[model samples]
Target: MTSNPTSSPDPIPNIATASEAFHTGDELRERWRALMGPLGFSERLLWFAFVDTTGHILPALNQLPLDGPPEPYLADLLMYRLSDVIDGHDVVSVAMLITRPGADAITPWDRGWARLFTTAADLAGVAIEPIFRANAVDLVQVSDPRADGRSVA
Candidate 1:
């Protein structure tokens, strides 16, 4: 039988055992580096925070899945898990501030949290400044300060 050049089978490599998988720190860094390539800056920062704080974010992420919507409790749990790393003293406060307010307006909380997260990411050397600036522009445009009973009108 002739093997077609375009029909190569997928290569399966040896997988790490459960105990080996849970080995944190440098091991986790290696896994993350392999999983998320060089351009995955945000993920790398989060992984660093996870490794620094509790040596693992995989357990929390594992509780979720690759498919479907994450449970509400999972979001809460994630926020709690990231609290220290994000330096967010009040997760509920932060959450409440960012939720949608109406059809066309970006809430103050959204801006606040963006600023906070962006600041934290900058301090962590995550190079998220451009993302933050883009979002800030979007928020300003969506809210339309002049239309929000502001003196700018």
Candidate 2:
């Protein structure tokens, strides 16, 4: 389940430096877009980027295996573990991205994952920015829908 339709090399998008701020959903979505880059993948991956209290991005961008919906218990455990890392920080939040092979549209499955993640973060008392999804066609913000009843990319 993949597509490499382009004969030319795929362009690598620029990554945000540690100094860059991701204060808004738009900024976070841009980061996800850069990380995703003309999306085409054989499997799904969950990516995370931490933001400090001042909105500056942490140095690391994490990637984890994702075969299906996240286990509730595991999600809790993961968030709790990460909480320790930012415990002493002045302020911190999380940004998530799900990249898989598919069309641009957000599916019910994607919404389900977003709900699970939001719930887990709520339980852990962790703040999370909007979540984004990158598919074979486009990258979009999945957590919050626009006022016009549309998803933004």
Candidate 3:
């Protein structure tokens, strides 16, 4: 019997467990790094993980398609889903990651998505932490002006 080389094991060895605390931006980035593995995706994806005011992460972490649907519709979808988990006690915040297959540099496109989400979260009255971006080279905390609380168009 010959073993198949094509069938490789998953690269991500460990993932964040429920209720794990992420108190700061650095900690959140580390968790994103763990979740993202070596940073490479064939298509664009937006990853979401719920966190509480005390920094404890909720059990739900999901990846959604980045394309299709208008931005407002997508934002509405996200807000609707988030409302189910939020109780204003245990689950009060969210963290996001935008990933794609490309160079590590942050792009305008990335900023646009971040801005849109930031605006949506604001309107929905949800607390949002700093968003992050990942590509073929690196995972980084998004530092765009929009993400920093500037108006989103």
Comparing candidate 1 with candidate 2, which one achieves the higher TM-score?
2
Output the lDDT of residue 44, model 2: 83
lDDT of each: 0.28, 0.68, 0.71
**Given candidate 1, what's the lDDT at residue 117?**
45
Task: Please give, for residues 1-153, the per-residue lDDT of candidate 1 as tens digits.
Answer: 112356552222223321134232234333333333222111101122222222233322121221222234433444555454443221111111121222233445444444444444334433211111111111122232222331110
Candidate 2 lDDT score at position 96: 81
lDDT of 3 by residue, 1-34 (tens): 1113565532443665324567667667767777
Location of the lowest summed lDDT over 10 successive residues in candidate 3: 1-10
- lDDT of model 3, residue 16: 50
**Which number leads on lDDT?**
3
Query: TM per model?
Result: 0.23, 0.76, 0.77
TM-score of 3: 0.77
- lDDT per residue for candidate 2 within 1-153, as digits (tens), equals 222465454344586432466656676666666666667777887788787777766767898777877567767876787677656365477778888887647887777777677778778877777777778766677754422232222
**Per model, how many backbone clashes are there?**
1, 1, 0
RMSD of 2: 5.3
Residue 36's lDDT in candidate 3: 70
**What TM-score does prediction 2 earn?**
0.76
